[model samples]
Target: MDLPRAFTIRESSHRVCNPFTTEKLALLGRAISPSPGTRMLDLACGKGEMLCTWARDHGVSGTGVDISTVFLSAARARAAELGVADRIGFVHGGAAGYVADDPVGIAACVGATWIGSGMPGTVELLRRSLAPGGMMLVGEPYWRREPPDQATVEACHAERKDDFLPLPELLRRFGELGCDVVEMVLADQDSWDRYVAAQWLNIRRWLDANPDDELAAEMRAELAASPVKYATYEREYLGWGVFVLMNH
Candidate 1:
């Protein structure tokens, strides 16, 4: 019912929990420009950054759901800190198959499409909770450059080359699913660095604090190898972005 401790530990300091930086996220909010008081439903809404900030900056209200109790607690605290606690709610639950009781103006599943199996199914699931003419925001990764071989794909943490499509193909996918790509905010290398490199620091800090913890050794090994792997493979080959869509 909760995210693994290792994942929580690694991303302990993350706000968005994806490759998006605060600036990039703000850019996304501005790009989409959801109107004041718009209703949003965010699935796998890690730490509720989008909901909290959008509540504060855009006057939108929403509910967020995540499997991580730790993240949900952080999300609640963040909501309170931003003085938007009254505007947003965070629930502890699985996101998959969890449709909202009421349709919303915006339905989002960012960087966790596996909840619905993949992109197509995830879009379908989001649509179930979307009001007519409402928008959907999906954060996903696509290939920045084609991986040269199997080792490269594995290094990017993809099991197979087809696990992600190229960016153009991904947009085409939205068309195939009966949606129009209205807007998008993409992550650059710096955004990737801020997200992934920040995890290394969080992991290192945790390892130093708990040298004898059961996961310390694993964290240490990951810290030692992650930088090079990221620079060589992921930074060059993987791209991530949040796309806004509406059914045509």
Candidate 2:
């Protein structure tokens, strides 16, 4: 499927729907410390926000790959604004089975594991880019409490047992993938609210400007219904985190 325009517009909007905000970014930085100039790869790097920020702050060079044309344009603009275009690159491509010309010190599939099929597949996907002892970062969601019913999961567009795991099982899955539990930053309800709810205002603004765009109407419909659905369903039942891992 093509990248959704709603996602692209939301990416450029000042909303912080993506998990990589200043707090999360700081946590990710501390977890994946590529040596100076270490090459990094961000799989499904929407809008290149994390890579651009990482390169600028950590002095590492890297590339961000995503299938979203709209987000790629924003990523390019971000790199230019940060003056890191020379040190970093953005590829308009899919993350599934994607690799770099050279080995990278860090490989990440943050919040977009579906690109590699699922969590297990995505771990294998990122490992291909890792040099010996290199790190991989995965962002995922777990169930904070057992959801009372299947409808809650459906509201999040997930099947009853898909895309949501208990935190312990998440760590266990990483261990099964042959990675040590190196570091992790869990997102609380507040952060999850920041991620999902902030989207409403942006979509509202976009809907106001593009009153006639077909996608805007769809977005407006989703936005109007999302807040209550999100709070009662996903937020109450789910847990999320970005975990950094290294081969054992």
Candidate 1's residue-wise lDDT over 138-204, tens digit each? 9999999999999999998789999999999999999999999999999999999999999999998
The candidate that wins on lDDT is 1
Candidate 2 residue pairs that clash: none
Tell me the deviation in Å of residue 49 in model 2.
1.5
Full-model lDDT, candidate 1:
0.94
Q: Which numbered prediction scores highest in TM-score against the true structure?
A: 1
Tens digit per residue, CA lDDT, model 2, 1-248: 45877676665564233544667776678666667798899998877877887788888899999888877888899899999999999888778999888899989888888888888898888988998878898988788887777787777667866567789988998898889988898888777777777777878888888999888678878888888888788788877788999898
lDDT of 1 at 237: 98
- Every model's TM-score: 0.99, 0.94
